[model samples]
Target chain A: MTRLLGLDPGLRFTGWGVIDAIGNRLRHVADGVIATDGELPVPDRLRVLHDALVGLFSTYAPEEAAVEETYVNRNGSSTLKLGYARGVALLAPALHDIPVSEYGAMAVKRAVVGTGAATKEQVEMMVRRLLPGAVIRRADASDALAVAICHAHHRTSALKVATGTRMA
Target chain B: MTRLLGLDPGLRFTGWGVIDAIGNRLRHVADGVIATDGELPVPDRLRVLHDALVGLFSTYAPEEAAVEETYVNRNGSSTLKLGYARGVALLAPALHDIPVSEYGAMAVKRAVVGTGAATKEQVEMMVRRLLPGAVIRRADASDALAVAICHAHHRTSALKVATGTRMA
Candidate 1:
């Protein structure tokens, strides 16, 4: 069994989800959002996000991690701020010696909902069906869960290929 | 006497300089650049930068720090990458509980060369004059040193004002 953590990073809200994967079976463990105070200075806000992730790593103790790659926006300033948060999200897992995998949004959507152009609602519905009774609090948290599910699916397929099993 | 560290953050090169400030006198201690491997993955590169800064903080143990504020670029992707480095730079000092101050490029140039519009060569010349016999390694390192000198000057002026002494 391998435990995985998925992160959807943003400047104001960083969502995280944890799951355990064994072959094709997956179980949701936990999920939540790390919200930083926007009124604080950029550095202080980044620190807040970093410390929160550090705390989460201590509590969850995932063996591996995955992150949704950022999509650069048209607004340069906004993209820059998002990158700052993404840096913290990536760094925390790495500091814990957890190997991280990144998946683009289209890849994640296809993996989770079987469609690269799936809408947000479609992804959320799939997540709910995949992990029954998961109380996803916010869209960010749900997005994080979707990323975790995607990783679980990808890892399972890779394992099958490595073992000379039929590609599922 | 106060020990200060200054940083010029970039995705490819992060420059750092340490100095000791006593009243109106400033002396350079050390300066170097943390150059990340561009070929590596983004998260791995960010981890490399973060670890380097943490090592510097441990080695120098500066009481305070200053960083050149990031100027957003027209290219969103480039600006985002720069933000990742800046995030690491800012987080390191704050993680050490060292107070961090930010200065715009114009402010730093004005402080070091008495002109906000000073050219790069002019700033370099002033840094060489201020720290005589100092071996400047790279442009990034010199820029970091210039920021340190700027902070030292500003701090001294602030101290004098706080003590009710005439501004120098």
Candidate 2:
């Protein structure tokens, strides 16, 4: 079984989900959002995010990780702040020596819900169906779970290709 | 005397300069650039930058820090990448519990060279003059020194105001 951590990075709230993948089965391990105070300075906010992630990594010890890649936003400042949060997300896993893979948001939606243009509600519904009793409390956490499930599928397929085995 | 670290962040190269601020004198302690390999994946590149910065923080043990605030670039992607580097730069100091200050590019230039619109070459020349006998290296490092100098001036004035004293 491969334990994976998935992150949906944002400046104010970074959502994370952990799952254990065994063959084609994925079981939810945990999920939560690390929220930083908007009133804090940017450096302090980043510190809060980074420290929370470091604690999470120490607790979960996930073998591998995945992140949802950020797209350009209309607001330049917002995009830059998102990039800052993404940097912390990527850095945390790397610091733990966990290899990370990134999937575009559209790709994550497509893999989880079979459509690139799936709405948040559609994706959330599919995530609940895929991970029964997941108790997803927030949209950001749901998105993170979707990313984990998507990576689980991708990794399984890659494994099948490497072993020259047909999908069971 | 306050030991200050200043940073100029970029995706490929993060420049850092250390200086000791004593009364009205500024003495250079160290300056260098941390370069990340361009061919590496984004996560790995971030890891490289983060680890290098952690090491610098351990070595220098600066009491305070200043960073050049990133300006939005014409290219959104480029600006995002720069934010990633800036995030790491800001994070390292915060991790060390160092008080951080931000200076705009123009503000730093004005503080160091008496002109907000001073050219890079002019800033570099002034940095060399300010820290005579210092082997000024890359343009990025020079810019970092300028940021340090800028912070030193601002801090001194603020200290004077708080203490109700004239400039020494």
iRMSD of all candidate structures: 1.2, 1.0
Which residue pairs clash within candidate 1?
A: none
True-vs-predicted CA distance for residue B104, candidate 2, Å: 0.6
Taking the tens digit of each residue's C-alpha lDDT, what string does model 2 give over B70-156?
A: 888667788788888888878888888888999999899999999898988899999999998789869889988899999999999
Clash statistics: count for each candidate: 0, 0
Q: Give one digit per residue, the lDDT tens place, for model 1 in B107-153.
A: 99999899999999999999889887689889999999899999998
Native-contact fraction for each model? 0.73, 0.62
Candidate 2 clash pair list: none
Candidate 2 lDDT over A1-168, as tens digits, reads: 999998999989899999999889889999999999999988899999999999988998899999888888777888788888888888898888899999998889999999999998999999999888789898889888899999999998898897886543
